[model samples]
Target: PLTVLQGYLEMMQEQVLEGATREKALHTMREQTQRMEGLVKQLLTLSRIEAAPALAMNDRIDVPMMLRVVEREAQTLSQEKQTLIFTVDEQLKVLGNEEQLRSAISNLVYNAVNHTSPGTEIRVSWQRTPQGALFSVEDNGPGIAP
Candidate 1:
């Protein structure tokens, strides 16, 4: 994706040199470049998280608040075109690395967005299971084939 974006930028630059409309070319270039950057950052973040060991639980965290952060970020990405409904059990608390948990949930939400269609609903919910907290992203979009 980054390479494709770079090629697009180069092509746009060539077009500009040949007297193409500056505004149109610049707009296209900016959008492609930003998308490429976002992809790279997301990949890097996932890689780092995978390479790191599981975080040790040393402090208590408000589970609902953490989930809200993930939902808010996902909603921002959706831009109101898609709805991200979040449901959390009241007074939920946990002991873990809040940031890492948030990242994992964000990744799931991102995956849901990619697989789901515009205007579809993505539901994020969390509850306490017998052993641990369960976080899920449910979409009305097509499900994976078996």
Candidate 2:
């Protein structure tokens, strides 16, 4: 994101981006700046989570609603390059730190989008199991290297 912002700053500094081109550059810069801010917040949340082993898992989070928000964010971030499929069980709910869970899920979706090619299909799902609830993010992206 910083790289993106830096590139845009350089472009703006070097030449006068005009009309639609300037608008597009400004829009992209804003998005990247927002992404960077989100990253910083996530890092701070992660640090806090690490320092305190037990995050308050008392809130009853609406899993489906949260997933929907995540889906929307992923769509914006991926800019329609990837096909996003969400299969969420409407009744599924979870007990956890809402912020943490949201952050984790967002990270998973963003990671998939970032790692995959433009045409890759990413699937996110949340369902109920006999023992508990299950959440997953899967994609037709390359496997991690050993």
Residues forming the 10-long window of minimal summed lDDT in candidate 1: 16-25
Give one digit per residue, the lDDT tens place, for model 2 in 59-105.
99998999988889899999999999999999989888998888788
Model 1 Cα lDDT, one tens digit per residue, 87-146 = 898687888787876777777787787668898888888888898778778997677567
- Candidate 1 lDDT for residue 10: 85
Clashes of 2: 0
**Model 2 TM-score relative to the real fold:** 0.68
Candidate 2 stretches greater than 4 Å from native: 1-44, 143-146
CA lDDT, every model vs. true structure: 0.77, 0.89
